[model samples]
Target: MRLAPDRRTLLLGLGAAGLAPRVLAQPRFVVPPLAPLRMEVDRITKITVCVRPFRAAGPRLDVERVAGKRVVHNYGHGGSGWSLSWGSAQIAAGKALEGGVKEVAVIGCGAIGLTTALTLLRAGAKVTIYAKDRAPYTRSARATGTWSPDSRVADAAKVDAAFPALYEQMARTSYAAFQTLLGLPGEPVAWTDRYTLFDGPDPGVTFPQRPTTVPDIRFFGVPLRNLAPHWNDLEPSQHPFPVARARHGTSMQFNVAELAHLLTSDFLLEGGRIETRTFNTPADLGRLKERVVVNCTGYGARALWRDETVIPVRGQITWLAPQPEVRYGLYYRHVNVLPRPDGIVVQYGGDSEMWGYGSEDETPDLAEAEASIRTIAPLFEAPKA
Candidate 1:
């Protein structure tokens, strides 16, 4: 029953032809190469410092009656103040409006205070923000702003059993809230591709660890990690970094200058008043006519409330004048560079979570700033032709 040699050859050729179409039917996807960053050292602009109000047991979101004033505490978000603001604001403002207080006062104008005030105003309550400093002048402005919901959010060992669920809720809510701000004027909030460059042969294991000098004590809430915007491992040719490996993810960044303006404008447009006033003690809050107040003093909470629980984690940013062509952010050798609409922020987190975990120093270091530029400069070297 065997076919003759010529007939058998013809039958094999037909089978090969059939396989060709199936192979060709499959599509190939290529990762587009990214634009090279302009990492020149001379591009440096300004440097600033901020103290994140880290607390072991997470943010203080409790209520107390002080001097006949119902105080809704909403401070100590650590590095996550900006990221978790809206969600936590919803909680804080809800407590503030519990008794149906028509006139409410917010004591602090950082991300938390402003958002809480806006949330209160939207809840149809007359809100006034009485703070010593507004957005730009506050320590919140000096932050290395990023959507870091759990960046030193809490020491897991120190948080309560219920805290993780609460943290996840806040992170999820804030993620949804930021989405509505996309495509707005000024590009107040937007997504940027972030590349993490590694120099080792095996870039090793899952979730892709970035090397750090200090122990990473920061709490990582793994529940909402699926909500991570984007993640893709890139072949060496797909990226311009001169590294052994590169991993990419989409990180949400806030153009603080624009974001602050938008939040401030929105509050006022909705009939919320912002007064330049400072509170030195709990008694000062009683002087105001509003019976309900939400305390969002951030690191200042340490002094005003005499609450020793609030720990300060210092963070500094070295800004370079913005380059319109640069649209991406990157991490290399533990230093981070993000090109924002306002400025190109360069921060050295080589020490990782503990870099400034307990520091409160607000002094600007020019040498340390220059060192960051040096660390990132090598990656942007003109690629060989």
Candidate 2:
């Protein structure tokens, strides 16, 4: 799924994709009149969903001791896997380079694997991606493709004081890298304006409060510490809904399908190669021509590497007709509505947030799909007239 381009992408030389008749003809947005705040249940006829189930019966990761046989474990990122792929890959490869290996094998072909291959290629290391599946078909393609790092990475404080700096650096680097890709002929990546509405008391948190000149680090909604007035104001007539506050940010959005191909093409263009093979055991890492390996297996790490820390937090999304007029993304409570070129991706995080708490495997639940739509209906409700 691809997010529509916002203002930043244009300035950064990252152009938007072909606009639909409505979007291209009138690129401006006149805030729609607020209808009565009434939530209408979408008439869901046919349903499709992506289900992720978890089993506690796995090995916990000694994250510090993650690497093996010159292999740096880069999997187990869970939901944030796609959002943080390139950043994490850069970090993993940075560590892998310490081994001084000029060649590397990337162990999964999802977003993590593909990005790692590109990162390695840029580092002048020959890379071979070994995976069972390809893009669009891969699990990474199933994501809604928003750039927020929340819920995906481990707690910043727990990881280390320095870990936040590392995470922030990777994010900035990947942001720059993606911008470069967006400037290419295809416009494979871009940014979208995401609106996260809140109705209740303030979460008492601000974002982008501390300003950094870093390209990827920008203020979202309001300054992180500003409490005096507010960032955006809503008039009685233009209010979209009866919301206490709203925070909006320019977020990184990409067409996962295009991005997958872009990464692969970039690698091949740089003389990196890909091979198809499955590793049933860790021993396969030793057999590869590359001495260093970066694991991008995603959820597959559970069985292949017998990783216990890896847990599946199932997420499902509903694809709806493109509403190009809806210029912002919405996250209200657990339900989120993300607009993409193909359709709107809606999802709700259920018991799956329990982490190592569920017994269900990677099963698709259409009912859960319907339920997720119901959960976020309020955010899509029209404002009162």
Candidate 3:
């Protein structure tokens, strides 16, 4: 005979008895005001190109002994250099400090290099960055500057089993680091609304009815779609887009110019030094007086160390005159429209995410820019109901 049901047992019995059906409240979404995009092609101010250092095996963060000095590799972030800069720098700086070195040398002055130098300085180490080019002039400045931590970060097949968890850690670390810069004088980093538009049911959208075993060798350790916090699905009537579906989320968009200035200033103020010099080979690193060297050379790492795995993923952006009225970003028809403090950036996402792989062509195509503008201009032409 069973004893009288306890509260816990009674709840289990009630659930098994189907006494009540679980009901969840449907979320009420608010529709934002429709703002027409300013897409005048004639107002285009500038065009810039950047090459992302994509490594199929993911970023190289291992330590090596070179010329009797400790060399910490911290490059090869692919499209995520801007997104993962701080976190990756932290890892590199920690490794550099493993032996408790008092001084550190950072090669390259892009996002990764500057952050690494700053990180070392914060940790009570004398830091110096040696590079041919600096921020605002480096490839990092040309980035679209969105918080996309896993965008082509690695090829799943090439990464190890532990990479996803590690990637998550770095992504979270970088996110937290960027938060400290928000609302500062230059507004280096700020939250902005991003809308992913769909003409119909987006072919890119996938709904897994059941969990399928994903192979370990994938570009992302975890899918980027699952990482963003303020992501929401909206009905056509609940969004400002003319499209059938719009995925809305809030992301930290960096004003590259202001961010570079801020990072450079912060690094200098913290006693970090910058040396404008170029290195042709890994052997050149030995010339530096510091016993520990952190390599943040980005794509230059491909040639400096002769690493064949580094691939160039070229990206171009067309800037239109500043449009203060435009506060949101939109990705539609493989075109990205991002409004920032400096200018409005319009870029092509290409047929696939890896469309420009291995291409170093920096030349900006005006015809291509015009075509991208035409594709999304119609959305603004439609009258808001």
TM-score for each predicted model, relative to the true structure? 0.87, 0.70, 0.86
- Candidate ranking under TM-score, highest first, comes to 1, 3, 2
Better of 1 and 2 by TM-score: 1
Instruction: State the weakest 10-residue window (summed lDDT) of model 2.
Output: 214-223
Superposition error at 339 for model 2 (Å): 1.5
- The runs of at least 3 residues in candidate 2 whose Cα sits more than 4 Å from the true structure, single-residue gaps closed, are 1-69, 155-161, 183-187, 198-233, 242-247, 323-326, 350-360, 375-385
Lowest-lDDT window of 10 residues in candidate 1?
A: 201-210
Off by over 4 Å in 3: 1-27, 200-218, 224-227
Error of 1 at 124 (Å): 0.9
Tens-place lDDT digits, model 3, residues 14-76 = 667788543433345555664667787898898888788989889999999997789999999
Tens-place lDDT digits, model 2, residues 1-385? 2234555545444223434222222122324432221122364433333323222221112223222466677776655556566777877888777757788788888887888888888888878889888776787877777654444355332353455565565566666667676655444676655556666323232211112221221111112222112334444333455567656455667766667778777778889877879888887677777767787787787788786655555555666655555555666665677665555676664422432222323555555555556555644443443
RMSD of 2: 11.7
**The candidate that achieves the highest lDDT relative to the unseen native structure:** 3
Locate the minimum summed-lDDT window of 10 residues in model 3: 205-214
lDDT of 1: 0.81
**Once superposed on the true structure, which residue ranges of model 1 sit more than 4 Å away at CA?**
1-33, 200-220, 382-385
Question: Could you tell me the TM-score of candidate 2?
Answer: 0.70
User: What lDDT score is found at residue 197 in candidate 2?
Assistant: 62
